[model samples]
Target: MTARALRRRAPEPTGSGRGWKEQTRRVSELCLLGIVATVLCLPVLTVGAVVATLSTVVAHWIDHDDLPPLRDMGAEFVRRLAPGAVASAAGGLATLVVVRQVQWLASGAVPGGSPVLVALLAAAAVLLTVVLLAVPRLAGGGTWRTAVTGGWHALLGRPAAGGAALGVTLVAGLLAVLLPGTVLLLPALLVLALHAVHRALVPGAP
Candidate 1:
């Protein structure tokens, strides 16, 4: 063979190249899932189920390094419907109570508007962090009790990471409140942030 021919290298296998392609595909899948999740979440009662499914998809991707079929997610969603809806309803009710309390205080019906607002915001941050952890636990095959208690453990064990996740949620919430249109982006951002937090905080989490 000529020197030039000898110098040429054979094409490499596509396995590694496929990784980036795989990641890109996963990202697109996440976005699409987020879109579906956003629509499902509109009813509000399905919020917990949607969040759980989002976390399940994320965990599945992390653990298996593959995209689960949409049908699998759909099946899981169906299975989780009852519990998820119940949880969502409870959470919504609690949130409504908080909102009403906050409004009452702000309207001068009570003595401590500023203090109440600050306290409520802090409470919300903590609650949001717990819920984020809980959903992923459920997605990972944990029961409701495990989801709740494990969430607290995860949050306490990794305060910094938990705080960061809560912070992202808060900022996104504020932006949604202010711009309204930015609410459209909240689902994708929340899922991505919570997935990152789960990877960091959940032992054996994928």
Candidate 2:
């Protein structure tokens, strides 16, 4: 065969290929990561660490355009466990307080009634948004203290990005509540959404 004919017959390099197959592969990887992270979080206390590790993995994927080995996630989870526990405890306490307050307000035990309840709900939403934005910082190898602080600053610095991330999370929560089955994929989707929002908004973020 002629050189031109051989060249035309040669398959395109795998690395350079793009289309639905590549998109499907990426989605499948995220689903696997989500399932694995959810399983790791079954202990409850490890939820924070699992999220942080997943965030790191997703960030790595975003930077490199490929997922890392699954085994590496386990090592990252262990390394993050201590600080993640602290974050989890703090987050849990805060959630408990908010829930209690919401319950009390909803029962009409408070003076302002609906207005007060609305304000409280808004505050809780803002707090959750800040925490969502901070998950990526946890993977930056910082202490829980630093991650929380950085997350607050990041939200303040980029309110639009924070709002976008919060919207993504709320949508995910709604889907989980409505579909139930989607809970299996929620973890990875949340991490990916947060990272994508940050990468798209913040200048030079990976």
Candidate 3:
């Protein structure tokens, strides 16, 4: 074999190495974002704003291939705070009510146990899916009312996409339950999943 022939036979470097490196960097960034979001959510009421901020950050990253500055994220959180708090409170109350009902039903206090329990579970799942689908819309710059309405419509418009979002939420929740430490990353993971699901399911989604 001649030297020239041997050189030509050498395999060209593929982009797989670069792809893996990019994926790793993206994952690291998401982990950091998740930790920051978890800290911001410690106040409880701020959970909604933190989620909106995370969603905005994820959207920016998806569109720009870079994370926005912390200052920008902070500003976004402050802007969303009031409405976010209200929404968070309402959501919390609703969740509590559902949980109580579930507990009551599970304890056999209710007459129609299995059917009622199944209905409640289905409703909860649907609500969770709608909220998951709507988080990405929070980045669209609108009143909370509009964002929520749009999210609901989005779900109606794309039932399959809503199902996919629900699956992602369920998987994320299961992972968080199985690995308590992942709870810290849950917000970021969810925001990223929301973006991925929307972008894949909705054409021209930035």
Per-residue lDDT of model 3, residues 10-128, tens digit only: 88754344567777887889888999999988888988888888888888887777789878887898998998899889889999999999999999986779998999999988787
Per-candidate local distance difference test = 0.75, 0.81, 0.84
Task: Say which prediction, candidate 2 or candidate 3, comes out ahead on TM-score.
Answer: 2
Scored against the true structure, residue 159 in model 1 reaches a CA lDDT of: 83
* Ranked candidates (TM-score, high to low): 2, 3, 1
lDDT by residue for model 2 (136-167), tens: 77665656677667777778888998889888
Candidate 3 shows a clash count of 0
Give the alpha carbon lDDT tens digit for every residue of 1-206 in model 1.
78777668545545445667666776676666667788999889898777777777777766676658879988988877788888888899989988888888789897887987889878976887887677667766566667878788888887876777777777778988999875655676576777777777667666
Which whole-number lDDT from 0 to 100 does residue 14 have in model 1? 53
* Deviation in Å, model 1, residue 93 alpha carbon: 0.4
TM-score of each: 0.79, 0.88, 0.86
In model 3, which residue pairs have backbone atoms overlapping below 3 Å? none
Give the total clashing residue pairs for model 1.
0
